[model samples]
Every structure is written in C-alpha cells, then in structure tokens.
Target: MSGSGSQGNGQRLRADCERCAGLCCVALPFTASADFAADKPAGQRCTHLTAENRCSIHAGLRASGFTGCAVFDCYGAGQRVTARPELTPGPEMFAVFRVTRPLHELLWLLTEAEATGHGGAARPLIAEIEALVDGDAAELRGVDVTAWRARVGPVLEEVSERVRRGLGGRDLRHADLVGARLRDGQLRGTTLRGALLIAADLRGADLHRADLLGADLRDADLRGADLADALFLTQPQLNAAHGDGTTTVPGALTRPVHWPSGSSPARHEAPHRARGMPPGKAAPVGGGSGLGGRSGNGRRTGRGGRGRRNDRAGGADGTEGPGRRPG
Candidate 1:
C-alpha cells in the first residue's frame, strides 16, 4: 500500500485550510464507534468539538473512550490550510466547517491508503483537494468546488487501476527515504517501525511522520521522496540512506548486511542484543549456534567473526568451540 506525502513538488500542492472554513469533516459522515464517541451525519457538528474550532476533548480523548481520535493523523493538512496568507475565514464558519474538512481529508487518506482498483482516480482527486486547499478561496469561489469534486471522483476510480498494476511495494519502518523518488506513489505514513532504508526513492509519495524505531541504514538515496521528520528515525536510517564508510548505525539497530552484486545464499538471521551479542554477528568459526553466521560453504570474517568467536567460542562439552566438533 502507498500514500502521498507532504514533500517534493507535491509539497507545494497541499491545501491551506486556514483560508477556508473546515469543509471536509462537515461534509462527511461517521458512525458512533469506539473511534468516535458520537454518531455524526454529514454536515453535522461533533459534540466534543469546541465552538472555537478546536477539539474540546483534545487532551482527554483517550481517557474519554475516544481511542480512535488518538490514532487519527491528518497528513499536515491542518498546517497547510493555516499557512495560507490570503485564505482567512471567520471562527463561526470554522466551527461549522472544521468537522467536514477533517472528514474529507480522512476520506482522501483512506482512499489512498490501500491498493484499491480506484487508486488512480482517487490520487488525482486527493491532489485536487490539495490544490483547492492551497489556493485562495476568493479566487476559487468562482470555480465550483462541487463540480471540481465531481470531476475528480472518476480519478479516484482510476486509483484502483494503478493499484491493481502493483507498481510500488516498499515497507519503510523507520526507513530513511529522504529525497527518494516516490513520485505519484503511495506510502502515507505506513507503519515503518524499526525499518532501515537510507535515501530510498520516494518522490511524490506519502510518509507523514511514520513510526521508525531503531531502523538501520546508511547513505542510500532519497531524491524526490518525503520524509518530513518521520518519528524514531534515528541516525542509522539517516546514515544508511546517505552514509559513507565512516557512517555508523544507531545503537538500537544492527549493522546492515552488505550484499555484493551477485546473488548469494540466504544467511541465518542475526541475533538481537540480548543473546550475548548484538545483531549481525558472524557465525562461529566452524559452525555452532549462531543466528546469522555462515555455514557449509561460507566462513565468518572480520568483526562479525570476532563477535561470533567471543560469544560462541566458549563451551563446556570439551569441544574447542560451539560449532567446531571434536575429532
């Protein structure tokens, strides 16, 4: 699945909500589910929303049994709207419009979240919303938003078309895809917890502060991508995506496995920090219990070998090491 991002040329294509009254949320509908505390119809007010156009339950939503509100993330849509210079509207209108605007954005995000048969159409529609939100409403008041939305609806239909083709598949858990080439692709803050992808291609794609716990990578390539201050993307994702030999992965992450040009046999899984050594440790010299060491046709080398020897070299069965059998 992919999502659009707030970076690249597309970054300039986002909506400026400050100019307009909240439109999307007021225009949308929702059921009274655990995520939402009340059932609201399209064009209705949310009870928890304040008159000043802010969430009244902002701080206490989770404790108030609105866990859904906690998980909701708008891809900087609110900031973009507020940043517009000429698009200022009154609080009265904002109070009524805030709900719809967020709802519209939510629908748009959902449309792009999955690889549906309508991805192509949905993408441009989302783009249209971005464009509309970016422009001065006074300038666009003459331009029929309803007609534009109607025109863009079919584009959403086409979103499914592109999605069916299976063009992009990338999991960026705490991945460092800064400046990556993710043009017109999807990856809107997809769960990238503890992934490593230094400088990957992600232009015109989505990535709104995705979770990026202890990911590992160094100086890769990230042109035309959207990182936008992703969360938990420690120095490793940065270094790996765009690092040199001097680059170092974060302590939480293990060193990446460097693969040469040609294909090689699959190695063992690297160990986590708890198993006496960190991840990516080499196999024992001869072969013993090792998560990622080589076997049969391969030999441990350099630091990997050293870590392996230090960890598994000790034994009590009278053998020289954990892997080396007694003759």
Candidate 2:
C-alpha cells in the first residue's frame, strides 16, 4: 500500500493533478518528438491543456504526441505551489518546483530508509532536510544544491552500503550497461545513476538502496527484484521496467499503475507479447501502468529505448529525468 504521508509534517511525493493548476504543463518546456508532440516554452501552457487547468488529452496523450506527459510525475510539487497562490508565476514559481523536487525526492528516500529499518544517517538527514524544505522559498533558493547533495548523498550511500553489502561502494554512475546480461545480480548500494540499462536482464536482482536516479529501465526485467529503499526512483521508472507483484519496491512507491496484478505475467494475458522483440518487452509507448515491453517478441521493429519517455532520464549522462511539476 502507498503511504498516506500523514505523519506530523511528512510530504506526499506523488503528483495530485486534481488539486493542481496545470503548473507542470506550463512551468516546464518540452520539444516535439516521439515523446512529445510539440515544443512548449517555460511558463506556457501545453496546447492540450484545458481552461480549468486540466489536461485535455490526458487519456490519449501518446496518440496526441504528448507521450512525455504520461510519464511525468510532479511528486506533489504542483499542489504545494498552487496552494500558495501568493507566489507569483515565472522564474520564482518555477524555482519553487525545481528546488523542492530534489528535496521531496530526498524525503521519499528517507521515508524508504526508515521503512527498511535504517536508523542511521537517514533520520538525521530527514530532520535537517525537512526543516530546510519547510522554510521560505527564497531561503530554499539560497541553499547550495550541490553542497546539500554532498551531505545527504554520501550519507544515504553509506547507509545503503552497510545495510545491503551487495556490490557495496561501487561507483557505477553513467555506466553504459545497456542490454547487459546481469539477471539476479547483487547491485545493492551501487550507484546506477545515469546508467543505460535498456533491455538489460535484471530479473531477481538485489537492488536494495541502489541509486537509480535518472536510470533508464525500459524493458529491463525486474520480476522479483528487491528495489527496497532505492534512491530517486520514480513511478515512471517502475512503469517502464518489467516487474511482477513479487518485485519489492520502496515504501513510498506503489506498483506501476499498468502492471499485471500477479507475481508474474503470462504470455496469454499479456497484450504486448510480440515476436522478435528482446527477452523483456515494453508496454505501449505512453502506457505506464503496465510493465514496459522493450524488445519483447514482435515489438522490436527497430532500435528504440525500453520506454520512449525513459530516454529523457538516460539522456546526456542521465540527468534529464521528468520535467518539473504536473498538470
């Protein structure tokens, strides 16, 4: 079950579009591509958005050339900004979303750390970071993002390492591990941030506390993989990756909305099981609720990443990731 995020001052890190003001659709920019239908500038509303700040083409985002929207999650930043209407729109508004994003991500990881029985650095980092996050937006902007990352990143890394010693202390950042065969590998505490894991075989891998930030997991098999306390991993990552009910996820994350409701997906029930594709198959381009079928059966056709939107995260040293806020 997804956490209620009701602890005294805990935050809800998932996007709540109903209470938002289409901030994501306007605050962030997007370029036309397989992932996006058109180019929109920062602070400009997406053409597909409605007057009431709702997405007009939300259900058929992919068909309408806005597949990027389907994979994006604001982690509740949009609602927070909307609630504080006093904050003017523009750079400052955008900054509030951007600055809070990493902080909320940190909160998510801290919550997971606590859930997984971690009592060390996570608790201290959570307390310190939460206080900073709750401060004024201007104060948050004054914060040195890099310096703060330095303090929390290393601590989280160490805690994850001590807890799950599998491949501990390995700096696998920006590794080109695409299509590599490592089913059931011990990747605990490994820095897989920015790694190209497209079509990789990670079935049953032990990924406890792995830093999967900006990692591309399209069509990568995750059946039975233990992703407990994995850092910076979002729902889109899980949706793009292939996993069964047995795949262990962090406490703050719920199963992908598109996954099969069982421990494993059978060929008969899976719609994306095409021939000539890779071992693990990705789902439809913009369909994130189901596990993606990258090269499964007949879905290969050509050279495409596991999930279309996933390419953003793994793009350019794997730092792009989902854009700010949510519609």
Candidate 3:
C-alpha cells in the first residue's frame, strides 16, 4: 500500500538503514503495557528518549517492565549505518535511523513475507529499496523526504551491503541445536526459543543454561554442552532433539520427541574421557572412540601403547554414541 515496486532510475526503491539515520524508535507509537509503561502516540517522542535521540531509560527498560523493548532487533539498522564507521557526527546520527523508521517497518514486513514463503512479490520490492539506499547514502543527512523518495524507489531490490553485514551470523533466537557440534564455542545460554532439532552434536560447548523455550527434538547430540539450567528450554526442544526415556535436558525443559523407532532413549551422559578426567580434558582426541576407530586418537595421545591401550580403554570400536564432537 505504501509504495511497493521497482521504478525507473531506481526511484521506486525503499530507504536503506545503512544509509539513513535511526528512526523506528523515535517515530513509532506504543501503548502502556506490561512491557512498556508510557503511552506515546505515533510520530511522537518517547519519554525515555533524550534530545540527542538516545534512549535515556535504556539501562532500566527491563526493570521498568519494558521487556519487549529489550528483545526488539532493528534488522541491524543502528549498527550497520549509524553506529558503524561512526558515520556522521553525533547530531546527524540522531536523524538517520528516525528518517527511515517508516520505511524500515515496511521493509520488515516484506522480509517477513519473504521468509514465510512469499518471495515472488518481496524479491523485486527489496531490490528497489536497495537502489534507493545507494542514492540516499549521504543525502539523507538533511531532511528531504520527497527528494529522497524521488531518488529512491518504492520497493527494494537485493540487500544493501550494510544490512547483509547485520545478518552475517546465525539467528539462534528461537533455534534448536541439540547434540549439535558447538564445542568450545561461545553459545552462552543463547535464546533457542522454539527450534526443531534431531540428534545434533553439541559437544564441549559453553552453553551455560541457554534459553530453550519451546524447541522440538528427535535425536540430538548434546554430548558435553553445558545447558545446566538454561531458561525457557521446554519439553519440545528436548523431545525434538531425541531427549528420551531417561534423557535429561535443562532442568526446566521437558523431552518432547520420542526415541528412535526401536531403540530406547538413552540417558544424557558426560563425555567418555570426561568420566575420570577434569572438565578441561573432557574432549579427548579420540573423544568418541566408540564411533570412529582408535586411530583417531593418534593426534591426542600419540601411538605410544596403541594396541594395549585400546583394549584397556574398553573401546566399543564401532558404536556411534553421543561423544562424537563435530568441528
């Protein structure tokens, strides 16, 4: 409805956050609720926001019942353009995100449509938006909505380099990576709200009680990942990842997925080498010695006692258990 297609000279494209100032926060309307306390109208200023356009109540948003504000992601608008490269001076940065706020909302809807399997209309629209962004990179520093729209297009085509940079990493929010190989990685209780995973390989990872709100599971591999008491991890995330008959996920989460067809669900066990060794040595070279051959341990302990050590370790030799840590 608010301009939705590509035009000539790329004038039909939408605004690009990377090339604009931060807008969504200052322009949008919000009602008082459990998440927000102030009742502000559209295009009005937020009480917590300062004259420099910074949120004065940023630190106390959550404590003051503004949880929703805490989780909102502006599709990398702030970091990509305004905060990045220290784009313009402080005063100029204020207007950047705000000017493009309305356009950002529109673009967000299109992106949602694209993600939900409606790419046909969204694709070209996004392309047009990209072109406009290129033209407005430096011009939008001042306020000229018509000129900006005239130069840009109604829709966006392709992604701006700035926006793309924002989504470079995985959006683990509401994701499920059970038994997934995230060893020694920095997944500190990530917000895996409601993801579906089956037998992932998460070994020796530092998942200090991640939030697993409502994930699905079938057969995941959470070998050594420490989700000790992660928040929100419900039964769904556990069950979808093969959390079974005796499997123990986070203390607060429940197992949703049934075990494999014929086999009984196994219990959550520590890494083999981790049995008697310290937590540091949990991920041994032949970590899951049972899955791969003992030869894999060559790098860890060397070929010192090869044969004798193999038998003494009571190696299963061919059974693929949960200890196989993916790189």
Alpha carbon RMSD to native, model 2: 7.9
- Give the whole-model CA lDDT for all candidates, comma-separated: 0.33, 0.55, 0.35
Worst 10 residues of 1 by lDDT: 317-326
Task: List model 3 lDDT by residue over 28-94, tens digit each.
Answer: 3444533345555544555665555555566665576543344233333443445346456344444
For residue 182, what is the lDDT in candidate 2?
Answer: 77
Instruction: Give the Å shift of residue 202 in candidate 2.
Output: 2.6
Question: Which one is best on TM-score?
Answer: 2
Off by over 4 Å in 2: 1-11, 88-91, 166-173, 184-193, 204-214, 224-232, 244-248, 262-327
The TM-scores, one per candidate, come to 0.30, 0.69, 0.29
Given candidate 2, what's the lDDT at residue 294?
17
The positional error of residue 255 in candidate 3, measured at the CA in angstroms, is: 23
Q: Which predicted model would earn the best lDDT?
A: 2
Instruction: Tell me model 3's lDDT, rounded to 2 decimals.
Output: 0.35
